[model samples]
Target: MLTLTWRRGDGRCAFLAGMLALLCYISPASAEDGYDLWLRYAPVGSSKVEGYRSALGNVVAPDRTPTQRVVREELRRGLAGLLGSEPRFRASPAGDAALVLGTPASSPWLAPLRHELEGVGEEGYLLRWTRLDGRDALVIAAHRDIGVLYGVFHLLRLVQAGVSLDGLDVSEVPRIKLRLLNHWDNLDGYVERGYAGGSLWDWHTLPGWEDPRYTDYARANASLGINGTVLNNVNANALSFSPAYLRKAAALADVFRPYGVRVYLSARFSAPMELGGLATADPLDPDVRQWWREKAREIYALIPDFGGFLVKANSEGQPGPQDYGRTHADGANVLADALAPHGGVVMWRAFVYAHDVPEDRAKQAYNEFVGLDGAFRDNVVVQVKNGPIDFQPREPFHPLFGAMPRTPLMLEFQITKEYLGFATHLVYLGPLYEEVLRADTHARGAGSTVARVVDGSLESHALSGIAGVANIGDDRTWSGSHFDQANWYAFGRLAWNPYQSARDIAAEWVAMTFSPAQEVVRPVVDMMMASRETAVDYMTPLGLHHVIARGHHYGPGPWVDGGPRADWTSVYYHRADRDGIGFDRTASGSDAVSQYAADVAREFNDVERVPEPLLLWFHHVRWDRRLRSGRPLWDELVHRYTRGVRNVEAMQVTWRRLEGRVDAPRHRQVAAFLRIQRDEAQWWRDASVAYFQSINGLPLPAGEAPPPHPLAYYLSLQFPYAPGDGR
Candidate 1:
């Protein structure tokens, strides 16, 4: 990976050392796919290489346990990749800078410092410099072997980020108890809303041939401290619960177990009827309850550490307890009861809306769930989407966040860009995730941010979690686009610490993925920080949402109507007309703002107090109404659409300037994708302006370009084979 030239008593070697030191972290310009994600431990420069080699020259970790075995292997792999040499394995600390790793039980040297491990908890670790056997060594101690594994990854990440390890005294404990990935992948290798290639799990060869890629997947997730993974689509198939498929899942569990990643499955609610020989699958039925109990026992028998199930019941034509005329609590309690014995959980989804469209679709989930606040079993966590509606480019925080304080609510975020130009458009989701997490719900009073609710700080609940819909696939890059990997990385970081700054996470990702040089990190992070808002400005600025094409949800479709359900159409959300634009959700229209806490409802109901970005979401205003920008609503909308397209143009220019600073293959791919994004941004702006202008009969603002063709030209576009829409 690196060339070294040594000359005995020669000045030529000194000259080469100076040049190498000046280069400081040479970018691995060789061709590389993003398969490595953020764990690419490229060789360091001459300046720091010697120090790192001395510090990590030997390992003193025990390999008796499975987790300990993996920890030793990971250190060997990481050290070899970064220092260009494999570290020596020693039974005891001997070198001046050996890495001593173990719990008090595993290594007797850590037993004396047991009191220092007070707040680190079971999964947390303590890393500090200490004297071992009268020699200077870095100690990575924890309460358990899994914590030791996490500590190893943490140390490797710091090395990759070029951090100094001299005074290393750090303690890390995950803020959320369940950091998980929900894969919307089906058994047939087709992904529902997946933008990457096929599903990661090849079902045909599983249970026997354990692919090495599965091990790599665990390594990547473990590096980020993500502990759990739900291994199938929420639109579940009952056959997955059959004996054949359960064995397949058990095989995967064994592979992930050593890396601290426990596998969970998306349970079909009607599995008793489909997989078992039961007549009815009612949650209240004694027969159905017993069936689930037996199923849980069967699962635990194969995979002792099975993480339990994620159920998406009674939504989007899926079966649930409602089909049996019961509440959601009734549906979830049965599964929770079964899994509680094995120390598992039931993550029941709250993305539900009735077949009969309500006055506001945004209010349905809050209304359905708020009534059953304290009714659910303790092992059941109600999973909620970040926004009230679907994962649009932008939307207000869901009102249900603070409503169900009595129940454990796990925040669910979609990492896949189903809405914001899937995989092609360079939209970093860190800003979007940060915005919603920072929004205050005022459940108790002030300082009641959504992040508090998710991390169980406000509610003081024992179980806390945050899940992201996985963007991973069988593609070589993992995520289809290299930049999309940032979303997955950011989600895991935020899950580890809810209050961390998203911009800081972006910088960390950039430094590890590309060159650690400020020249590359600064511009890439700046572009990422601004990319989300740029897409929102062009796609759904000023809180306009669900304005994408039907079914596929690819491009502009504000004219869409006549769907099976009104909630499925773009017209239902925006409700733009010649008289006025935007939905009226205040008391005058749907009264949907009433779902929030009294203070938040008041702010959302009043036109003057509401955040200007969400003005259209709450109150319908006339085109001539003035905005905070001192322009009329019509003019502001036009300005935002144009601004979005301009931002994409600027991004393209930014990427062009970073050509040689990044690897040639990845750089070329990003540039080509940015070009695609620029064209699509133009399409979104032109198509939206043309359609809305036809309703209001307004002339174009000065210097704004008109649509290239008539409105029909934009409307005539069709995408029968869009990548993610597996249906």
Candidate 2:
């Protein structure tokens, strides 16, 4: 209900408005394009404006450091936008309601609370309502400048979410140490698996032309507490380390430094051979080792606080130590030894699969890593994907989460909708992330959760982290679609605290991104909470994984086969036949379930005991096998696929109801995208049913509609120009 007003005192409001618009990337028109993301500080409702103004009327914070300067600017910009008035900036806490922000060293008044600050560590903050100058004051104090910035963002987030700041009390420290976004962006500005437009990093215009967009990118990541960003594709080019590109990276590092975001690169393991013309790129070779060591030094000299390398070696034809008859440890250690001198850690990816077929692709990473648990150097962290297989719509947590105790493991999640609808479907990944994190690994007794393993609590390891494959691009919306932006936001929030609720995160995102009204927030949150399951039901119900089309992964391709490798085809995963439709990973089959802890393995091994959602993942039962729904397996599968399509329809309806409540532009875009999702859901459902029925020859369930097209019709569909298919 609060309306915008111009302050007539000394023309400061006019000056402040221009500054806020420039800093926040505000456009001339009022229409939203989602560039601002959740940081858009629209004015609060009338009921809460007065309370927020009272709590944040005057700000007292230092600008001695770059981080401190950004904090003050952010507070000024955010407060002016949220309260519709520029709050007074004071040298010290004096007003009846003042917001004080600084570290104990910067603000002497905060020294008395040093004991309370002890638990916050170096990058944590403490916020509380206290009496200063015998008046009400809210202090955002930290042990470091970066923490103060994080605290300021947190306070602004609360304000944007329409929370009461009367008794504000918050103490937050990130559970994970290195929350990073891995950009699969090549030097040519092409993003692999990126549904958004071209890469955000215009490599052609870098170092000399530092895009203001780069600073905004850092701001968004800093708001989410993501402190690191891997700027290139995992399929790295050696030129990224070239002097020209390194200078380009250095410029980005300088821009991101103030926001506490350190730049990292996806280092090519064969860089010695490519860049330095070495005879052999073996990790054990003396020349190769020295080359990497010197390379690390050169990089650090250019960018002192560089966060080190993310290596993807020996996976999908990438060169690695394995090519020279060496192990993953050898490959990681050489880089780790080089970076250890500069206090940098190497994040070595564990997503490896051999050229020859294995018993099960899901079992490969665990088989490769579990044996070398303690072989890794102290500066090496094995980055494992959330699931053992590729980023399936629904997958059991990777077995290696608890298997490797000695070595620190970083959970890698794909924020891009690679397997989902790729920016077209409204699939909120918070629930998926939450499900994987909360999964009980049962490694050390009864309740060894994956979250504990990633946070280093279960193993008491010194290092812990999580990484997200970024969906960001040069598109105006940043993530190709408005809804896709939530995944990036959710990943950062979950990385900060893995134990938080997905529904709560969804609610917070809905409030910040859209309206905070219960009508808008409630339905939107409900849709988001159910979206992942809805996608699973239509795309790959009952633990069905990797059933998408051959190349671009667009539509259903249950009949797809005859690829270069059997594992690359859809048939290798689902394994549907006349008898059944599911992969059997039990003792009689591949025994992939055995990789898990005893308790988890036992449940997954038994079809009756395993969760029904994952029925097909472990057991290949008969077509007539009775499911929990009292219907046979085939009927239940059809029911689930149909149910998924219906749920998408329901979501379309839900979104339609918010036409006027939400902004016209975003609302129209979401509605169109939802229509596409609904249509695609139908396509996925019908095509899958058509293909499966050809194998099973089963009659359609009662009230179930038959596919309008035949299996061959669906099979003949081709997409030669699908987006994000760059190899």
Candidate 3:
């Protein structure tokens, strides 16, 4: 009904019309909902086109395997968009430029260079500019088809970033052995703590009807060099392992296999009794061992490269080997033995806590696993959360990073915005992750960081892995919000190389996701860099942890005291009184800092040496205690809270200036989300100020306004149906 017309010069219109008539294609730049994510291969600038256009006259791709086909198709799509014309396929390098894409086994040209690709391994590729038959060309060669696909994406990334393909010499191999994303997705499509929509796996229609989103999902993960994914929630159900569900998982696996991503399942440990007709699911029992072995066999039959079980045992209400008076190592070893014959690894979650409130809730996971360090099977990786307690806004490095040297340990981080204000708050988790990774664990020496421990550099272990609790769902944006996608991207980049800088990754994401223009990238990345600290300032400043509302964790609840388990309540952790505020993990209190290495323990215990950010986490300071800022403890807390709200306002101002510059849809969405963050940050500041003032009875300091409501008014507010609340 409507004819597309451009009021540009006639020459430009004629050229564009000719291109449209010839190719009949549309660039993904028109996609406003962010369905393309960072993979949007929009047209490059004239400079990039000039540098790369003559070098991409044809492609010499000889393979026709599924993965190879995928890489070829991606190149075609990307070249067409980025270069303004797709390259032609040539059997020989007859053109002046020919991009050769293949593994050694698939192409005669690459077979000679196979010796150079020796150390790159099965998933790493070698991308370089080389001469072919007296003509300059590019070569992307790897040991396997999947590796070629990764290189193809990397090539496209360079193009999107306006990087010249000339003189490109890159050889990339993932530093971590297994980069995994643990989806807290249930069978019924409900995602636990998922800020986005339902699970990507439509369980009802899966195994029969496959959604095109699945392919894009695989492509996105593969682009980041992520090799494995756990499909269901770690708080698992036995039904996920049933024959019907296994088929559905196999379907996802089939779609992912081409992209070199393996699908894993969170296994319910008590399935021997619940699914099988066994009275006792003891690890020592021959029948119990046989049941798991059969289950592993059945899973491998359907998914040949199936990743092993992700077990959450002896924690929460989930059943485990502990139910039969067995040790955690015993629980892990049984499954490890079953998966051993099939070349699988059992990822046993260490996010466990006793129902009984110990001297300190943070000390339980350390107490449980420290005794059995050398007892776990070689194939069993003890998956430890970054913090001892939970995925709080800030906490000291977990004591177990290098505590279990004899056992292969994997670092598990939550990418979901569970405590950082769900999906609404714009908290860039790169700095948060970097903080934990760079933390000196002091396990081996002063330089022993958590990153070294996870990458197996500290322990020199053969197996090393890292996991991120995924924030992905069925939303058109992939993540709930557009900027939230940056967190996902950051996690994958860090997972591939734990030592990579978060700010650098954020800048790259900004360039690819939004634009390469310096005007837009500079402020957006600055806002992202400050976002995590801003959230921490308002939500849990001065190292305060777990003060969020009970159950839902929706808003402020510093006064929460009574619950079934005292540890579950905010009052137990905060321990605010008329005299002082904050939990005292010092010698006079819980002495929880003593669990760390001697130097770390000393630093955490010393009030003066402890970092100001975590001061309240380790010490209970009096309201009148003067901080390094020369302000009283109460005044400093108020300053931080108000500063957080003001910082959000500053971010709003930064975003508002880019309205005409950024795409209308994305710019409008981010502006709206920034408003949410500003309001909620103020709520956090006011409600927290009100609650704490009731305790310390301190008046608002100079330049600070009193809260609009009393402590009771803030306390009376409830979010009964907040998104991502665990029902």
Tens digits of per-residue lDDT for model 1, 1-727: 8867689778888888888776654444333678788888887766888898888888888999888999999999899988899988888775454789999999987887699887898889998898777887898999989889989988988888788999999998988999999999999999988989999999999898999999999999888889999999999999888889999999999999988899999999999998888999999999999999999999999989999899999898999999989999999999999999999999999999797888889999998999999999999999999999988888899999999989999999999999999999999999999999999999999889999999999999999999999999998889999999999999999999989999999999998898888998999999999999999999998889999998888998999999698988988988888988999999888999989889999999999999988988998989989899998999999999999999999998988999888888799899999999999999999999999999899988788889897899999999988888848
Error of 3 at 370 (Å): 1.1
Model 2 regions more than 4 Å off: 1-30, 95-97
Per-model TM-score versus the true fold: 0.95, 0.96, 0.95
TM-score of 3: 0.95
Tens digits of per-residue lDDT for model 3 on 40-81?
Answer: 877888876866767775889865799988988889988898
Instruction: Give all candidates' CA lDDT scores.
Output: 0.91, 0.92, 0.89
Which residue pairs in candidate 1 collide? none
TM-score for model 2? 0.96
